[model samples]
Structures are given as structure tokens and as C-alpha cells.
Target: MSTIERKTVVLTGASGGIGMATAKALTERGFEVIAVVRDPSRVRDVGAVFQADLANLADVVRVGRELAEKVPRIDVLINNAGLHAFSQRTTVDGLPVMVAVNHVAPFLLTHALLPKLRASRGRIVHVASDAHRRVTTLSLPDDLVRTAQFSARESSFLYAQSKLLGVLFTKALARRLNGTGVVANSCCPGLNVTGLGRESRTFAALAKVLAAVGAFSPASGARIVVRLAADPESGSTSGTHFSRDGSVKVDTTLVANVALQEQLWAETARLPAVSSLGDFR
Candidate 1:
């Protein structure tokens, strides 16, 4: 008789939407789901939950270290937590709330757990969005941590820029993980009716209406993430941006701009909140 090995996945933002759905799907497929959330009680029954307030970068580091010390091996890491702020906000780390939650925190967590991921030769999937191109222009370094001063009217564009950073981060990470057997990729969840907009009642209502019409369900949006995390075919694939239909797509200029990616990656590492991550090598 042969014994089967159980795959373990560490996921962020499993309290709702694509993250929650992906957790369930992975669980059904016999993978152990470890969720990093703000409230463990909310997801206690779903899988293992580690409490962390992603808005606070220090907390992210604490939680990441905890996971690194505890989990023996991690087969996959899904950076699924995200936030689209209606107004400019800052986290305890003094970085823009959107940038902190959507990008920086994930960067920190992934680095903290790199050793475990390397041991398992794991995969990393970032829940990005086609909205990256919507930013029009990216003024790297500055915009990566500083949210442009804006009103609610311009909030969507800010959110787009954050997701764009995720794409760039994945591209840079893939290069770094080259010989380590760890692959990195980003995916667009389409327009799912997730609670990402609960801060605005009007937007929330609109999302509900659109969801009822044709927006992908949370479960539907999670499929690509699950595939990227668990499918053997995706193991060899890295540094690619995947769309809702599993097609590779990101602005040509963005992917070709290796200088931009490198600059961004270097600056991200030096961020006050993440500077201490050291080389997880």
C-alpha cells in the first residue's frame, strides 16, 4: 500500500469572498487550509486560522513569524487579502492603508515564510486584477507606499495602482525564485461580489445587483486561484498574470520593463515596515 501526502496551503483573507471559497474548494480536494485573518473566530470551522490585522504591518510580521515557526511545510501561499478604500487611510505602519493591506503585507508574509515554501517547493498565487492597466501611469517607488491624496471619486484608480503593484511584485518574485523550485503568479478574480466594498453602502448595493446579474460568484472567481495553487501544470509556470479565463495578460510595457520591476522590488524591501525582512535566502 502507498501513502499519500497531504498538501498544505496558507491563505490570507479567508473570511470572505474568493479567499473563503478557495479555502473550501482546496479543503474539498483534501488540502489543509491555513487562514491568516483578523479574527480567528470568524473562520474557526473552515480551517486553521491565525489572527492578524493586515492593516498593521507589524502585526503581519508577527503573524508571519508565528506561521513560519509552526507550519512544518507550506505547499502553496495564496495572497488573497485585498482592500479598496473609498478614502485615503493610513495604517499603524504609517503607509497607505490600501498599499499596506493589498501589497506590502503580502510581501512581508511571503518573505517571512519563504524558508518553509522553499522546503516544500511551493507555489505562490496573488489575487490581482486587470485593473492594473487602469492606473494610466505608475510612478513607482513613491506610489508603491504613498497613496495619492484623493477623494472618493478617484478611489478606484488608486485601487487599480495597488493591484498593478501586485503584478509587478509577482514578476520580480518569479525571477528571484528561479532555481528554488518556487513559482509565482498573479490572477484576476473578475468582478466578484466580495465584501471588499462594505465601507460604502451604495457601492455594496451596486455590487449585489451586478453580482445577481452576471458578476462571477466568489466560488467562480476562486477557481483560477485554486488551479494555480494545486495544479501540477502550474508548477512550472511563473511570473505570469492570469485573467479570469486563465489567459496570460499584463501590459507589455510593464512585463518588459525589468528595470521598473527591479526598482520596485528593491524599494519594497527597504520599506520601513518590511526593511527588516532580511534576505529570506
Candidate 2:
């Protein structure tokens, strides 16, 4: 089974619960796996690790370029890396850390590798969350660059907003690749206890307690992402959103709004990180 030739999957957050699970599952299914993580030492047994801090746009952009140059072909790019900061912190680029890691970094990385992906007619799976349902509205220009401070209690709403941005990005990207073979979609992993906000010893204890309770395991969350990345049938479906179950269709309140989606695309494109790569319409 050495060097079995299936497509390759570029998975972010591969060291985390769902990422590790997805990397193993994809490997077993014969896809070559390349993991992009913040700390390479933290991940092993996952094929080829490329380290980059998603919270740092410069680091993310540089890694995106390196991956495109190094990986001959990319069949699927899963933007699974994300965090829930109990308290607000901002990146050097001035975007909220969560937004930087979860949404902006992926947006930039996906575009950077668009050529290889386009050549391979690949699929892009965004690891979004159902928490997007909590936000009733989103303002693109303001939200993308907001530097205001918020308490831990206010962080969940911000996290939800970022995921909703992912949904918008998926739909908009799918539209952009309308005739191209490349496809894009997003999914909610459902109450994943694997990643509860970072830097909290309290949440760490809660995670172990939840682990003992046998709820929302990371392996379980990785299933839909695996299906979306590996299933030939799923390759044909783009711009569709999936629920935690992977069977039910999630509501597309903001996701289905073409106008909003395009606006997000335009605004995201306007960001310095994205614009530095290339002009994306």
C-alpha cells in the first residue's frame, strides 16, 4: 500500500481533534495527506506537516505560496483550523484573532492555491459551524476589520459571525467557479468538544468531563468533511451547506443570499492580504 495514488487533501488544523481524525481517515481511504499546522511537532503520523500560524496573516500567506509551489496537485483544501478565544485578542494585522484564523487565513490560502486546484478541478471544504444561526445580520465592511474589544460573554457572537462569513465565502466561491470543475461548500461539525476556546484551564477540565460522557467526538465531526472531500458524488455538489448530521440541509438564511455573498467576496478581496495575492472578482 506504499504510495497508493489517490487525490491529495490539504487540511488545516490537522493536529486538532477533527483534523487528526480527518487526516487518518483520508489516509486510510488512499488520499495523500499534507497537514498545515501552527506547530509541526504537535502533529505526527499525518503525512507531511507545513507549519503556519493561521492567526498571523503574513505567515498564512507565505505558507499558501509555499504549498502551491510544493504540492504538485491539491484535490481538496479543508479549512478546518479555528479557535474560540474566551477573551478578545487581535493579530498583528489588526483583525480579531478568531476571524483571522477561522476565515481570513483560509480565504487567502484557498485563493493562493486556486491554480493547482483549478487545474485538478478540485473541491474546497470549509469547516463552518451551525452557530452561524445565532447571528441575525452581518455587515461586511465593518465586520471584516472591526477592532473593538469584547468580553468573553460577547465572544460567542463574534465566533458565530465568522462562521457565517465562511458560509458566504463558500457560496460565493462556488459561483465564481461556476463553469470550472472546482467546487466549494461549508459544514457544521456540531458541538465538537475538541476545540472549546483556547487558553483556558477551566475549559480543559470541561473537555475531559465531556470526553468521559462520550459526546460529539472529533472523529464523529470529521465524517462529513471526509465525505465532502473524498466522495465522488459530493464533488458534483457545490455551494450547498450541510448540517452536523450530514444528512439534513442547513438553513441558508444568510448563506443563500447571493447579494450578501457577492458583497463578502468583494470585501474579502479588498483586504490587504487577499489583494496582495491577486485581484479576485
Candidate 3:
């Protein structure tokens, strides 16, 4: 008897939340799971772990390049790490913390490892959210660089806007990757039982109560992500929004607006943080 080789999956935020559960599921499915985490000590039972604090753009870039260099055959790249701050916070780069971690870091990492992904024809899955609808309007170019202090109550709308940007990025990236054999898609993992500690103590306690009632378990939340990332049936799928269900794509003006998506892509590429990385596909 011989041990079978597993596909490579580079997952961010694997130390906790849906990412941790997704890491477990992907491992069980016979994929070699490589975790890109902020704290390496916190990660366990994965094939390997790479450290990168997504809130810091420089660290993300460095780690992204490292992963691209080290992980020779990446079959799936899941930009699954994200954060929700009730009170406004900014990264060292002066960008909003949520925007920096959720959107910008993933964008940079994807670009950094794109060559490997293209070579392997891998799948890219982003954990997005339905809260995008909470934001009725999106100000492009400006939103990409917008920085402001937001209250806890107002953070939801800002968080919604950030996920909306992910949807837009998926649309644009799928277009760029049309002939490259790399597929890109985003999904809302639903409200989950894990990752509550990062938000606040109140939410953490709420999560415990929710879990006691058997609601939003991590495995169930990670199912669609696992399917989108490794399922052969999903290989050709791109630019689709997997909302509560992948069979029914989520409909959002932001997701469908190609012109807006294109604009967002261009502006993101031109951002000082991203542009400093040089021209990226």
C-alpha cells in the first residue's frame, strides 16, 4: 500500500473561525492544507503553516511571495481570512482594518501567487458576506482609498461595503483569468459559531449560546467553500457569488456591474500599497 498525494490548498486565517474548520475539512478531503496565519503557534494539525498578519500589508506581501516560492503546486487558494471590528480601526498602512484585512490583503496575496495558480490552474475562493446589501451605494475609486472613523453601529455598513468589494473583485478577477484556467469566486459562509472572540466579548458569548443551540457550526459553514475550492464540478465556475446556496447565485448591483468592477480593479491595482508591489495581473 502507498500513501496518495494530496492537492495543495493555501488557506488564510486557518488558525481560527471558518478557516480553521475549512482547513480541517480540506485535509480530510485529501488536500495538503497550507495555512497562512498571523500566529503560527496558534495553528495545529495542518500540513504546514506560514505566518502573516493580514492587517499589515507588508507582512502579507512578504508571506504571499514566500508561499508562492515554497508551495510549488497550489491547486486551491482560498482567501478565507477576514475580520469584523465593531469600532473603527486602521492598519499600520492607515487603511481601515477591516478593509485592509478582508479585501486588500487577499488582493495582494492573490496577485503575488497568481503565477503559481495559473500554472496549476487552481481555484480561488473568497469568504464573502450577504451584508453587502446593507450598503445601498458604492463609491468606487474613492471607496478603494477611503479612510474614516466609524462607530460600532455604523461599522456594519462599512463591513458590508468591504464584502461588496470582494464580490466586485471576484467579478473582475474572473474576467482577467478567463484564459488562464484559474477560477475565482466569493461566498457568504453564513453566521458561524467560531471567530466571535475577534469581534468582541459580547459576540463571543452570543456565539457560545448560538452553538449551544446547534446553530452555524463551523463544518456546515465551510461546506460550500470546500466544494468551490476542490470539487471538480466547480472547476470552470468563475465570477459567481455563492450566497446561502451556490445553485442560486447572489444578485447584487455591485456583483453584476462590470464597469464598476473594472474600475474597482484598476483602482486597486493603482493603490500605493498595491502599486508598490509593481504591476500585477
Write the residue-wise lDDT of candidate 3 on 108-206 in tens digits: 999888888899888999889888867778886777666777777787788889988888888889999998899999888888888734567788889
Candidate 2 residues lying further than 4 Å off, grouped into runs, are: 1-4, 276-278
What TM value does model 3 have? 0.95
- Clash count for candidate 3 is 0
- State in Å the error of residue 86, model 1: 0.6
Backbone clash count for every predicted candidate, in the order shown: 0, 0, 0
Q: After superposition, how far is residue 120 of candidate 3 from its true place, in Å?
A: 1.1
Give lDDT: candidate 2, residue 147.
Answer: 76
User: Model 2, 202-270: lDDT tens per residue?
Assistant: 778788888899977899999999999998889889888888788656465776688998898898888
The residue-level lDDT of candidate 1 at 164 comes to 84
- Which ten residues in a row are the worst by lDDT in model 2? 247-256
Question: Model 1: per-residue lDDT, tens digit, 117-231?
Answer: 9999999999999988766577767896675578877888899889888888899999999999999999998888899988888889998897889676899999999999998
**Cα-based TM-score, every candidate:** 0.94, 0.94, 0.95
- Candidate ordering by lDDT (highest first): 1, 2, 3
Write down the lDDT of every candidate, Cα atoms only: 0.86, 0.86, 0.84
Instruction: Tell me which of candidates 2 and 3 scores higher on lDDT.
Output: 2
